[model samples]
Target: MVEIRGGAATSLDDMVFEFLEYGEESSPESSFSSGDGCYDDDRDEERSFDVEESKAFWDEQMKLLQGTFYRTNSVESKIRQATKEVLKDAAYSSQCGCGRLRVEAGGGCRSCLRREVCNRLMNLGYDCAICKSKWRSSSSIPSGEHTYLEVVHRSNEKRGELRVVIELNFRAEFEMARASEEYNRLIGNLPEIFVGKTERLRGLIKILCSAAKRCMKEKNMHLGPWRKHKYMQAKWLGTCERSAPAPLPVGNAARPAKSKASMLTFDLSEAIPIPGLRRTAVEVGVI
Candidate 1:
């Protein structure tokens, strides 16, 4: 229902999705309507244009996604809100984790670790997204210093504007569909982001995936990649890329049960140090 525009520049995902969808629609229309074989060649040529457009869009997107963070609602707030939505969706008893609904929350497997397992498989060890979510009347899960969701918010005192990211605990850390969007799909455990990290990152990933499921479930919406905002896409694609956030090692096990991959073996063969993406001097922030 909420078509995100004007609040900020359109995201790269939005552009890519829009472009892809338009190309798909135009393909059928532009083709068969060409009539006789004489004009058919011309029509086919048009399709090549579409192909070029799509390829160009995706190639540009890869650069953006690989870049630094984009500017949107306070990164801290958006991430915090998005994360909480996912966790709240998880606490629900009605949604399912089946592959039934792509965007909306659907079934009962949300709370199951198995569902999380399957999601990891889908995301290539990234985050565990709910397969589906069921409604619940009571969602009173235990709360504590360890149990509470970690959020980073914007600091009023910061120059320009700074979002308070929930401190992505890459150490503990961690969508879908539309014929238009691109997804990192796997049939089954945590996606790429969740395979390793701290409790903070893992916790944040849990919340985001859950919210994403719910958002899609309710309205058939998709969280297009952050690169959709042309501004963000450009920022992310800037000359100086930033390093991925770090994890929270000290408090790794505060809630190990919620994270299954915590037990997996990671190949530390290359004791590579942190990336130099952050060394560049740019007005960028990471959450």
Candidate 2:
């Protein structure tokens, strides 16, 4: 079951969202662990992260999800992105407009014309006259502003359906580094590293979402190191969340061809795994 909090969403089918990175070079920088404690460490962070580090991390994550379909080319992806943008712009302007930039065409409010533009783009989807018109900005953030991205696969229309919202943890980058430490410690011994750690990764994800929410809402982007902050491990993030269901032990099945569009991905790919043909431990000739 894939999950995210906050408001942004995207969907694709045939493949689950392995992870998605928004900016350039998305394969090498993402540091991730499954249920493992890859970077758990005893030390506190003392260094500042590079501005590009986040981009690198996302790129790496996207690499992990390559060859999968997100239905991005479809109008759906455009719609979803537009929806989030509209909401974000509205929120930014309503909340004092730090994110709002220059106002060239939209309308009156010189104060938050930048925000108004975003709202307009979001409301209009890809039909935004600015994008097609290639309207120039007097002051675009030279360095791209930090943005949130989500990865998803198509949901079965046969089944009901779901909508996801994800919020990032401001401290996730540090936690990832720590998880890396744990991963290093247990290189030769996963069982030991994972002892009592079935859901460490999930807990970490929750913490990240909380941090991102706080940062976005306060309109301040201040962040903390990941390793120092401890996450609560005793609870599930919420019942509304759903993971990609699958065969008990193995991971997800391979995805179908992808064309970059919005889609819904399901974990249990068999649609209905055949009972008799189901591979069991004995079927592997292990028994």
TM-scores for the candidates: 0.25, 0.23
Q: List per-prediction Cα lDDT, in the order shown.
A: 0.30, 0.29
Each candidate's clash count: 66, 53
lDDT (10s digit) by residue, model 1, range 144-210: 1111111212356744432121221122221344423322221011222121112223233433343
**lDDT, residue 120, candidate 1:** 29
What is candidate 2's lDDT per residue for 27-138, written digit by digit as tens? 1122222335344442112112432564444344333323222212333344344434453444333222332232322222333333343335434532221110011122
Off by over 4 Å in 2: 1-62, 66-79, 91-157, 168-237, 240-287
Would you give me the overall lDDT of model 1? 0.30
* Residue 14 error, candidate 2, Å: 25
RMSD in Å for model 1: 25.0
The per-residue C-alpha lDDT of model 1 at residue 47 equals 73
Candidate that scores best on TM-score = 1
Off by over 4 Å in 1: 1-39, 69-162, 166-174, 177-287
After TM-score superposition, what is the CA distance of residue 137 in candidate 1 from its true location, in Å?
A: 21
Q: In model 2, what lDDT does residue 184 have? A: 33
